[model samples]
Target chain A: MRATTIHAPGDIRVSEVPDPTITAPTDAIVKVTAGCICGSDLWPYRGENPITEGDTIGHECVGVVEEVGSEVHSFKPGDFVVVPFCHSDNTCAHCLHGAHSVCTNLGMTVSGQAEYALVTQAEGSLVKLDEMPDASMIPSLLALSDVMPTGWHAAVCAGVPEGGTVVVVGDGAVGLCGVLAASVMGAEKVIVMSRHEPRQRIATAFGATHVVAARGREGAAEVKEITDGVGADAVLECVGTDAAMGTAFAVARPGSMVGFVGVPHGVQLPVQKMFQKNVGLRGGMAPVRRYLPELLDLVTSGSIEPGLVFDSTLPLDQVADGYRAMDERRAIKVMLDLQG
Target chain B: MRATTIHAPGDIRVSEVPDPTITAPTDAIVKVTAGCICGSDLWPYRGENPITEGDTIGHECVGVVEEVGSEVHSFKPGDFVVVPFCHSDNTCAHCLHGAHSVCTNLGMTVSGQAEYALVTQAEGSLVKLDEMPDASMIPSLLALSDVMPTGWHAAVCAGVPEGGTVVVVGDGAVGLCGVLAASVMGAEKVIVMSRHEPRQRIATAFGATHVVAARGREGAAEVKEITDGVGADAVLECVGTDAAMGTAFAVARPGSMVGFVGVPHGVQLPVQKMFQKNVGLRGGMAPVRRYLPELLDLVTSGSIEPGLVFDSTLPLDQVADGYRAMDERRAIKVMLDLQG
Candidate 1:
């Protein structure tokens, strides 16, 4: 089986690797139908996160189950499913509370950017589709595996009230999806903070009522101006940088909340400022599994086109190009067609 | 009028100050019947928070309306009321959203530790009592002015679910009050972290199911042990120091929340740790005015005795002794009898 491997910083290659097999009673083997490069992947790609030998890459994908272990009762071979980014038993106290991202049993599972990946705790981690989705709808379905649900989590956790104003910080696929989530969730005004024209267009298509191209204090000032100096009712921090977090905090109205989903790195929250403004902060890894069912319904009903985030698609062998395109910002999301 | 003034750090005196008069159309002059020393007030008395000349020291009090400005329709002279520590118009966007602590039109107004204190935004800040209560009930009624509501805010904001486990950090009057709040809110088990014997007794009386007399790591470990390693479902952070905050974070269950109401100073949240655990941190200055009505009802019905925290009482001229007893931890709280 061929899979993406990072040997060193910026060194990503599609190399032949031993195929994954069912190793636990609750494990299942998934033949990857589609996968994509994540923004978090850039962390190791940029050498910010060190990579060791034989480290499997991606953590997002949608696939068909090829084999299941004895204890896997929820799925069978050939079943189309959305593989949650994190594996869980779904029975742990955390998972029962809808925090599958930090599931006490299986924790977080990786190795989805491959032809065949082993899925642990299959019963709780796989969201089976009612039937095989159309070939064209695969990208959107794959999004429910991680980014879409993450964006949705940000909107929901931020307490985006009905007919309220929301500010989305970031222009990546997740941020664009946040605009869609906020819109579908009934936000009357959705503001996307983006500096790029292409991303801004995607954001508007996804239901962003306004776009602020400025950065930092300037961006916050712009949001304030638009909201009559009261700021937005909620702010979704899709980017995890300190500057992005700062902007999210600054543009949030007093007593509102800022929900962040970006994997934070070297970020320190201004606690005093948050306290003074009575701003609540809540968001971490999204409970993707909890949101997959509803999001899949939305995709099937044609209510949201999250697949539009994938600007390019490549064969599994060309996964290197997909990574390069995403790393270089040439593509919002690069979907890898794994049916080769 | 005689008022408690902090001429300098650690220099408190009962000095003659100008009588407070109605300065705004929304203002009222209250003849303070009682006032109390707060844990936060100890900051200036201990020289941790430097005080300047003529700085009136307290922010918690209950009194009778002595005079009302033209726009103050909520109260007339002789009406008894609870003056919430933070003044608010209750009509601003923040106030309307129940964040009275950060009300836009009227910011925090101090000067409660005096014979006469000015109450601004009277219509929204004063919670009028139905009738003058017995002398014994005055302390409990005064508790509604700040500590009681602040503790209630911690439990409420932390989203304490029915029959869940709760850990209250800090054994001060507010922390003890938190135990009562959690118990009344349906928490089956309330764990209080305290080392003082008297405070522990008060905590148990206030409905603490268990007491962990450890600080920092040990305290967190004790809480974790008591909850069978799942950690508490909710944690109330009543102490503002970094150590107390750290313990609060350590004892919270994943996907649960930690509500903190102590005025944070020099506290930096370990965002990465909090993010990984999926713990939500929410709570700032308590919206005392918002919770006053319900808490007053509880007091009137004898459902809670939060005023029992006031272990000592002194006359207005002995305000310095009240501050001393609280600063030295000799009393849980000191009630100044302003009428003497």
Candidate 2:
């Protein structure tokens, strides 16, 4: 089997690797149908996150179950499914509360950026599609595996009230998807903070009512101006930098929320500022699994096309190009066709 | 009129001051019935928060309406009321959203520690009592002015689910009040972290099911042990120090909330740790005015006696003694009898 492996920073390659097989009684073998490069993937690609020796990459994928262990009761071979980024037992105290992202029984699992990946806790992590989606639906469906659900989580955790104003920070794939999520969640005014024309267009298409090209204090001023100087009711922060976090807090109205999904890096919360503003901070590694079922329904019903975030796609052998495109900001997201 | 004034850090005096009068159309002059020294007041007394020359120091009190400006229609002379620590106009966007603490039209008002205080935004900041109550209800009603509402804000903002486990950090007046709030809100297990015997006794009386005497790491371990290795479902951080904040985060389960109300001082959030734990942080200055109505009802109905937090009482002329006692930790709270 071939898989994406990171031997060093900026050194990504599709190389021959041993195929994954069912090991635990609750494990299942999945043949990857599609996969994508994630913003998190760039952490290691940029050498920010050190790569372990021969580490397989990717945590997002749409796959078909090829084999299941004895204890896998929720899925069977040949079932097309959305593989959640995090594996859970579905019965742990945390998982029972719909926090599958922090499942207590979560253990090591195979990477999805491969021809065949082993999925642990299959019953809890795999959301089977009614049937194999059309090739065109593949990208959108694959988004359900991570980005789409993550964006939805951001909106939910931010407590984006119906018909309220929402501010989305970042122009990455997740930020674009967050615009869609805020719209679907009934935000009357959706504002996307973007400096690039292409990302701004995508944001508008996804239901952003306003776009502010300014960064930092100026960006916050624009949001305030748009919201009548009161700031946004909900601010979704998709970039983990300290600047983005500061902007999120600054543009949120008193009593509003700043839901941040970016993996925070060197972000120190200005405690006094947050306290004075009375802004609520809530977000983390989104409980993606909790939103998969509903998000899949939205995709299946043709209500939302989150796959629009994927501006580029490539075959497995051309995986390095996918990384380069995303790393260089040439693509919001890069979808990989595993079967190619 | 007489008032408590701070000439310098640690320099508190009860001296004659100009009598307060309604200056703004929305202002009301209140003759204080009972006022109290707060944990926050100790900040200036200990030189942590510098005291400006002749600064009148106090924000918590229950008083009787002495005069009302032309626009002050909420109450007339002789009406008893609870003065929330914050002065709000009640018509600002933030106030409309139940965030009275950050009201836009907020103005400078005389401190409650004075014999006669000018209450700004009277309609929004004053919660009028039905009528004068027994002498015993004075302290409890005074608690509603700040401490009780602040504690309730912590539990409410933390989203303490019914029958869930709650951990209250700090064992001061507000922390003890938090145990009562969490219990009233239906938490089955209300654990208070306290090392002092008096505080522990007050905590248990206020509905604490368990008391952890350890601080920092050991305190967190004790909470974990009590909850069967899983942290509490909600944690109310009532202390502003970094150590208390760290313990609050440590004792909260993944996907749980930590509501903080202590005025944060030199506290930096460990962003990475918070992200990995999936813990939600939401808190700030308590919207005391917003919670006053409900909390007052509880106090009136004898459902909660938050006033029990006041362990000492002194006359207005003995204001210096009240400050001294609280600063030396001789009392959790000190009530000032203006009439005496």
Compare the candidates by lDDT and give the number of the best one: 1
lDDT (Cα, tens digit) per residue for candidate 2, span A150-185: 888788888888999999999898999999999999
Error of 2 at A311 (Å): 1.1
Note the residue pairs that clash in candidate 2.
none
Model 2: residues >4 Å from true position, as ranges?
A107-110, B108-110
- B1-340, model 2: which lDDT tens digit per residue? 7889999888998878888776789989889988888898888888898668897888888889999999988799999998887888888898988878888976534577888888888887888877898899999999988889889989988899899999999999999989999999999999999999999998998999999999888889999999998899999999999889999999999888899999998898877877877788888888887887788889999989988899898988888988888888888899998878
Worst 10 residues of 1 chain B by lDDT: B104-113
Q: How does each model score on TM-score? A: 0.98, 0.98
RMSD of 2: 1.4
Clashing pairs in 1: none
Q: What share of the true interface contacts does candidate 2 keep?
A: 0.77
> Which stretches in model 1 have alpha-carbon errors above 4 Å?
none
Worst 10 residues of 2 chain A by lDDT: A105-114
TM-score of the second chain, each candidate in turn, equals: 0.98, 0.98
Model 1 lDDT, residue B87, Cα? 89
